[model samples]
Target: MTSPSSPSSSSDAEIVVVDLFAGAGGLSTGIAQACEALGGTLGEDVRLVAINHSEDAIATHEQNHPWAEHYHAKIEELHPPDVVDPGAVTLLAGGPSCTHHSNARGGKPIREQERASAWHVLHWIQQLRPEQLLIENVPEFRSWSRVIDGEATNDGAIYQQWIQTLQALGYTIIRDDRGRYGVTLRACDYGDPTSRRRLFVIGSRTHKPTAPEPTHSADPEDDLREYRTAATIIDWSDRGESIWARSRPLAKNTMQRIAEGIRRHCDDRLAPYADVVETLGPEDVEQLQDDVVPIDDLETAVKERTEPFLVTGEVAIADGGVTGEEPDPGAVLVMGQHSGAYPRDAQGRPVPTVTTTGAIHHIAVDAFVKPRNLPQRGVHSNATYDPGAQPAHTITARNHDGHLVSPYLIVYNGQSDAADVDEPLPTVRTKARHALIEPDLFPWGLDIRYRLLEPHETKQAQGFPADYEICGDTKRSVRKQIGNAVPVNLARALGAHILSWNTPSLSTFGGGVTADPETEIPAYAEVSSTDD
Candidate 1:
């Protein structure tokens, strides 16, 4: 086999990259794309070597990027090839498994074995001594504490020690003047549709690289470009074919519970409307039931009946009308507009944070109420009707619970209307289960149902090329791979920034150099054999 770091040609000035713990080649692909954008020939001027423990992930990576050298072995079993000079390697990049350090994993005691995985990156750094190293992981990794001899150290002792070790090894770790290592970047800030936040640490042997500037912005004025919404990237034509499009019938018990919740919501909203009726005299109440009195006229009658209760001296009712203490015998009733009971967002905005599991909420709309003339026999109006204009919530793995993953409630406006809605898709989670409510399915009632997102749709949401193949036998495995992988556009933006540091024109942004520190490394923080 060829050496991992061997150049394709002697004449090519290649930027050799090794991605440790590489997942499905996200970082590798980004780096290569960035290099190509900056005039470097991929596979020639930019060589990639990806290492991951999962045979499935490695298989997917190999299928997508056959040119890159791949190793399906644990990081502990890998070493630099003797044919390559460690100093000649241009860059080393990796994101060790962040499960142990992730905030989502909760504050479990730091596992010694898992914490040691981070040190593996250091081991490679010691061997390769690459010019630049980029480490990506959960933001919480910076605050990870060390457990030495079963005793906990300082809150950030582990991360601080890692930095000091690199500094001692003749490298400059990028940090703000305040000594904060790693910059947190949101994927949407770089124009990826998904909203994923990741922490990145850059260590350089020669010069410090500036963090990439935001190309897209949440605010209109601050960004060079508007944030890319999910609608722009997702293929609406194939939406019906998505796994999420098919109905996953809810359990009978679950459906009953949802119906009860809806009933309760309707009751709450109707309280004030019912109160107006209570204040009416028998004749007025009969008039209201017969539609002889307009709703406004009934409200006026109710107000007149309660006028004596008005604490305010003024008798004339304003637009909002009289609102005060009740009269002893006769008080005019006041009616307030019913508030919506659901959550929704406009289609133009970014989606909520995508997680391992997806999010589903009822589409907020005007609560359904029985017509004053109609008998209150059954639940007629549903608050779950879809407006067909709001974006999706965060995507997650499980969407089986109707109470938790309350699918968007859609009421058929007309029989001729299509089921399609022009709204942003939710963040794609590992399970990729999303749902829609079809009121048309049941006679004058809403039916909540589930569907799965196609693997390609999930990939598209993550800013992967439409043609990118996700190699996995099971849909669950494929969805998991897509959810865990970094958004390709985000990776490209970061890669471009790194490449900029090497280019003369782009290097002017920060000279690719860190300012000389006004102070020295503290004496107590000196690197030692035990620091590991």
Candidate 2:
């Protein structure tokens, strides 16, 4: 075992990263970016070498990150693990194949073939022994080692076995004593407009005794922390406004409803579509216009918008040319430069946290509950926003496709610059944005009524470069990629804390802080003896 003591002269040269189970390279990208943020020279000598069991995933990784050497075979296939030079590896990071530990698999016995294949990561870790290790997974993994009271411990039983193996290899352990890690995280915590939370574990063979600190918190009493909400990261379209930025796609049913609502509200004032034309700054409105073409008439435009929002399959919007009444829904609609709307629940606040389970159908704007009944009341979250602060929580893909399900965001509610209570939602500033919404009014009645997030838009919400691709065209593949990965920004901030030479203070919403310092307990805190 190595301690984080004085480094050899060679240590300053470079640091190599080996990404095992490198699904679409989200973790690797985050670590690489975080290293860059550390403010030092990094190059080929200290770079990423990613490996994954899926050939398609490897290809996807290759497409985006040509610098990294990718291995398409399973980790166990490494004859002496020939993926990369063993001695050059500085860190090993990834969340392994989570099927066995996932709740979705449900009490069914895992396929022996897949189970056998999954163990290869442990084999690789044992063989490589990189200086540092980072692992991420759902919270239930804490008990994957054993079936509790014969209830069938799919998550706990397997995790216990995995950790035991690591423990045997002389790795230290750190888990959330209160088990809060797996909850959603809003992206605004790290200067992002969305809120996304993830469960992370960082261990090192050579680094000092340190772990990642909470860069964001839901508590309010703590100083130096700001509450990040949907109002913070306005949609790239709504930049400069105070709302969580969003570019998420809405579900078909929800899209229909939204278009109907907007149309109804603006009906009497509905002018010719051309009359409201606006340009997206100096840039040719062509780019934004091409996303959705507006019809000359209002009813036609509603139908055009509904086609993409409601249909699960792709519907190409042709040339985005001005079409007459009774036009094809497949025709593309052009959108002029305009501020985007806030994804809200029935009461007109931001939507609640979305999950891959119903990826598309649950799109409702969630809001931090504030009583219109009493203006003096504090913020309230209906299973969304922080209980104490004003910002969103965190945004993550939380799906296998690497598509963003729910952007952990705070619902921003306030008087507009016009001092009007009912002003337009703030525009976002980030490049490439999409909004999420419920598929239809009766989603629970039919599971088939699901929402589909555009692949590119999903990547943007998860903090991937705008052009990044997940390497699969199928829904199952895409959703899986999004669900399996970590929130890159969240990981980056946490990594900074773990890698920092000094302790970092919390920065998200200070809603997690306890009012009584001596109490050592907060309202939402769930203290446990097993935190070590």
* Best prediction by lDDT: 1
Error of 1 at 404 (Å): 13
Best by the TM-score measure: 1
- How many steric clashes does model 2 contain? 113
Evaluate all candidate structures by whole-model CA lDDT and list the values in order.
0.49, 0.39
Give one digit per residue, the lDDT tens place, for model 1 in 97-212: 77667554334556668767788888888988888888888787887677766544638777777777776676766664455777877776676665566778887766545688
Q: TM-score for every candidate vs. truth?
A: 0.61, 0.52
Q: What overall lDDT, based on C-alpha atoms, would model 2 receive against the true structure? A: 0.39
Name the regions of candidate 2 deviating beyond 4 angstroms.
Answer: 1-13, 40-42, 104-118, 146-151, 154-158, 178-196, 207-209, 217-452, 469-479, 500-532
True lDDT of residue 176, candidate 2: 47
- Reference-based lDDT, residue 15, model 1: 81
TM-score of predicted structure 2? 0.52
In candidate 1, stretches whose alpha carbon ends up further than 4 angstroms from where it belongs are 1-11, 82-84, 108-110, 148-154, 176-178, 233-445, 502-532
